[model samples]
Target: MPQSETGTDTAEPVTDHDAQAATDADTDGSSENGSVVPWTSITKPTDDTETLAAMTAASAAEPGADDMADASLPLDQVFAVLKNERRRRVLGMLKQTDDKLSLSDLAERIAALENDKPIEQLTSSERKCVYVGLYQCHLPKMDSMDVIEFNKSRGTVARAANTDAVYDYLETAAPGAEPDWYRYSTILSVGGAAALGTALLVDPMTPLPVIDGTVGCLVIVFVAYGLGAFVWTHRAD
Candidate 1:
């Protein structure tokens, strides 16, 4: 470089980048003309391919949905928690009560339903089994999702704000209101009887070509049994 007539060394030519750098340095983060400056500018969205572009576009479009990502449990997590029947029942119980529950109390209620007995009739083993499962597996998983606030120190449980998301898909019977498996057993027994009767009561009169006994007996038994079951099931109502 050579000195100019003004006695200062010849200065480098000013460029657009130099002016921009000087502008940034003067305001720190404030923009020129007193406008607000963005902390980040997307100069190269193509760096990350379409992912960054799509995300940036979405974020810019839906400013109000910023919290939507965290609004509910993720699908994989929700499905994992929902996969277990016991976990679903736990949510149902919490939704029904809508308050904190002692571990022992919760276990007793679940055990009673599981055993199809009253709370007073639940055995120690049944209660213990339910308690252990909740404590060891289910409770931890739900706590991770923050669906239930589980205080491990106090052994207490309460519904969390995010519980509603998971609870919406859950359906379960409260304690003392389980389905009657015995009724299903009756259907199985009747079907076996009907098949046995069909085998025994071979109707040679209608057995011209294809088959043996008449299906009328089977149909009659099913209709009669269905009526009886309907009556029995609705006895309380």
Candidate 2:
């Protein structure tokens, strides 16, 4: 210790290592000394770090991720969701629109369809009946499965990524709009049987042999139509 003329002790200078040790001790996550350096200042994260992190979060938040998540839900669950005719009707209405609609508006329209009246003619009771079921049950359940994005607070309904799986099982056409395949098939069967019977009864020299190939062609058309219908209904699934 060096004493001053006034008999007070003078303080010694702090070495770089001592100051660094003080800093390192205060820092909770700084790295230790490297090969030649005694200590180094830790680099703080820049804005780029936050930017990259936000980018990663956005990518994970994409609709594709939600789609994949919904895909993991069992198909039986989806079928259960569709089991209710009201829910099916809800989905149908949503499928028709490209943008969000108010819950009140949706309920009113559905009520109109069910009541066979225009929306203007819908009674308060009719609207409330559909609205209550949708608000309390259907929309929440569908939203839970990620089938639709239901903003309960705002009362807005919008389509979501999971629509395809449920929609695939629905008849897109309006009631009675589709052709009567049963009737067509029946006519073909009657025609085919009569021609085959005629070919059998007529002489082989009377051009009746051509009926065999004609019946075969009709059979092929029937099979093709069946497969096409199957494929059409099950597509995009």
Candidate 3:
């Protein structure tokens, strides 16, 4: 170097004072612009975690899953309650009303349905039959299974949480002296059997062909009718 460059000869070191000044400048710049920027910009990174934690806490504070499970009625109990016609009628009555009923009122309604008579027309023994059955047997049984609430002391009854389950199993109408379709089908079967017997009797005389085929057709019709009747009788309302 013929002549050393005076200012460039040695570079100035980055001292702590300069570094602190630069940091303070950055802090000041952030504070100045902070008012214009959204708070969301500052808080966004942790927002997801905070929201997730809040949701988790809320769910944990609710009733446990077991509580929901316990509210549902058991299938066997539903079937058991439906096995008796009186209990099914009781459920039907309760479903129609929103209020609790006295056992006497419930029995009157059930007795009317069972006897196919007006409540006023029901004989004392008829009423008593329903009353005793409900008070001592049906109501207690349903109460034990949570199908209905039976207040023994108050002599009141009301639908419980599981009452709907019983309703699901109730027949729309009582099996009712065999369905008309069933009787008609039975009559038709008898007619067909008589015809078949006549045809067999005359088969030797007339030498009719395809008697076996006719028999097969009759069998198919009978089986189909029987299956349909079974399904109709057993089907839910």
- Which should have the higher lDDT, number 1 or number 2? 2
Question: What TM-score does each of the candidates earn?
Answer: 0.50, 0.45, 0.50
Q: Tens digit of lDDT per residue, candidate 1, span 139-227?
A: 98899888789998999999875687776666554544644756665776777676766666554445443123335555666678678
| Per-residue lDDT of model 3, residues 213-237, tens digit only | 6788788888998898778656522
What ranking emerges by lDDT with the best candidate at the front?
Answer: 2, 3, 1
Each model's lDDT comes to 0.73, 0.78, 0.77
- lDDT of candidate 2 over 50-138, digit per residue (tens): 89999999987877864765676689978877777677778888888888879998899888776767899888899999999999998
- Which sections of candidate 2 miss by over 4 Å? 1-70, 175-237
Total clashing pairs for each candidate = 0, 0, 0
